[model samples]
Target: IQKLAGGDICKGRIDVYPKTRENIQVALRVSRVNQLLGADFSAEQIKEIISRLGLKVEAAIKGGTLQIEIPGFRPDLTREVDVIEEIARVDGFDKVDTIFPVASVRPVRIALRQTMLRKIREVLCHTGFSETVHFSFVECEQAENYLSSFASTEDKVISLKNPLSSENDTMRTSLIPGLLKTIQNNLSKGQKPLKLFEIGSVYFIDSQGKRVQKTVLTAAVLGPYELTPWKPRGKEYDFYDLKGALDNLCSHFGLQVGFPANANRSYLLEEKSANCYVDANELGYIGQLSPDKTEIAEKVFVWELDLQKLEKSLPPRPHFQNIAKFPETYRDISILVDRQVTSQKASDLILKAGQPLLKRVELYDHFEGKKIQSDKKSLTFALSFQSKDKTLSDDEVSPLFETIVQTLKTELDASLRE
Candidate 1:
């Protein structure tokens, strides 16, 4: 109805909309015979040529040549070539020369952004993650419920006014819900130890009252990642296992990954989840899928990342350095701190104090046993110290390591675990 009201009469092409007037009008300046056909001719010759095309020739132009108004029905009459073609139609096509067009091909380099994304997908696939794809359109209930963590009130979901079915009536707000359903279906089919991924779009409204979409990469793991022989004991897939996959992905592109300073307070996690970021943008969240959100009996660890944001955050040029020639001095220690104190805090302090020679800090173990305080947790880290020019000795590595341990003790009330 809107198309008809707007005067779209052509089947595929949009017809001229005569909103301001009852009919569309166009002016066509009749060029000289020399300009039109590359041949000199008199006014009468031009008029005679136009008269042959059934157009009424009017007064002369500034150079004393014929100019006339083109009819609305003749939409093709706008420029000199158009007029020349009409003249040619009355003239002879046999006289015009025809030439075949030439074709050329050149190889082009792939864009860095696209190359980065391709490498990401390849890395994930190589890490035993099978890619899954699904319909972009989804149920309204799905869209409203599985909104992205970064969504705001303006990020309204888009729903088709006329839909094929309720199952696919609206655009998805995130990919996790679909991925969860995929996991569920796989489990029902007796497929366990599943690791799946998807790269797709999530649709939402922008602040300017327009619909927008963001591309994301989402992955999920269920059951055990490795099949073990029938045994009484075997640990299932955990959050770190999924995180390790993601960490491995970021490392491929030289992308930096970080987590919030505090445990997520916005239901990101009560304990097991942490929001991941690249260059301060909340790319996505990696956490355990809550039971309420799924019927799958086994635990599921999921990671959702914004590949578009990841592309934007990639450095223009990646830095490369040779491995340190001197062997690294290693230190492993366990510190007891309040449960609320994040491991990131301790790691940052270790990096800060060990700035001159501290090579790397890694959390190797975490424990909250019966012997430990109820309100506190035991965190273990592996610290590596190295010097570019000389070997780092125990005398040099110990004091730097001890200074960081003391900083943790003073700053977070952390104590070295016996």
Candidate 2:
């Protein structure tokens, strides 16, 4: 009986009972043996042993006899001694300890890339810009019309075969259209003067005909510089405000920028915008809201910097230098040229000819009159000169200024006025 209940041996022969309660009579009959032999065993303990031997055993009193129910899985656990053995084995589980293992320690710090992104987010937050999260999927029409050069048939885009709506059919190619649409949606909800930013992935075709992904940081400001219900009048955002924000961002990375006068007109305002460049490579664009684009966001000014390019271009840290110890020499040259001549051309000529002494050149005035030639105008420039070793004098600077004027005159057919 012990061998069968302890799973040490299989029962060689088993007796079949006619009634269901007959198994209980057989179990009680085996328990009498343990009692008569002076072995410590209870009816409950015997039933537990029977359960461990893969049999369902139940006890009940009917006509003063202990009845039992035996399930079909275990014919070996026929008697009460078989049930008692399994109970004794399982009772040892109470001696086992209950405790958890200790975990290992982790180093304290984030990865370098994650740290950089956090700093970028903090900088944007400090500048009154709220961070926004958007889904990659965007409306097809908005993606094509608002985002520049997005193609619907491009395999790079993970399109939805069964889209829930037309608005969420195609994956976003750029962050601008989604942000602008968000601004428009907020405006409809009575939110104004929205200043928002998003840093996210943008997928596009690269020069090598492979699909490339880049992490971009984009920002937009719409409506006024200041909002007040009581005042009812505010200064609207313009190109310079957006340019200043971009300058701040680049300054954080210790970069110096020059605004070229010639900016492409297709995607931005030609007169109020400029393409950003670093080391002669075009970085991005900052511009005022073109009148046509202003339909969605009135008086909006936007700036987007390529984070991939900026990350590669940013110096580790910034350094400072002492201001000039010597006084600067100034030269003013007025050139009379045809109205068709651009300031960019005149500036380029001055820079190319001035060479060694020209520190800076700025156009101060532009005028046209009846006294001048019918097709000509007057353009004035202020040129600054300084030497690292000593202060420059008129004699040392005038000759170089003359060469600059002569170059403009010969190259652009410009003439000195006064």
Best by lDDT: 1
**Candidate 1: tens digits of C-alpha lDDT, residues 230-336:** 52346788887888898899988887677764224233346888888786777778888667666667888787877777888878888989987889888897999
For model 2, how big is the CA root-mean-square deviation?
14.4
**lDDT tens digits, residue span 1-418, model 2:** 5656665555596558764443333435445635433345565665666566555544564443345565655566566666444454565535334556568988988865676688788877887889888988788765555344232244345456888788899767677777877888999998888888898886655445677666777788887766557434767766656666777766676776666654554556665566677767666666665757546748666766677777777676668878988988888889899876766578878977987778787776777798789899898989888888898888888889889978997999999996
Error of 1 at 24 (Å): 38
lDDT of 1 at 375: 97
Where is model 2 more than 4 Å wrong at Cα?
A: 1-128, 146-157, 162-164, 189-192, 205-210, 227-235, 258-267, 270-273, 289-294, 316-323, 329-349, 360-384, 405-418
Candidate 1 deviant stretches above 4 angstroms: 1-105, 228-233, 261-268
* Worst lDDT 10-window in candidate 2: 146-155
Best by TM-score: 1
Residue pair clashes in candidate 2: 24-68, 49-83, 50-83
What 10-residue stretch in candidate 1 is worst by lDDT? 20-29
- TM-scores for all predictions: 0.72, 0.57
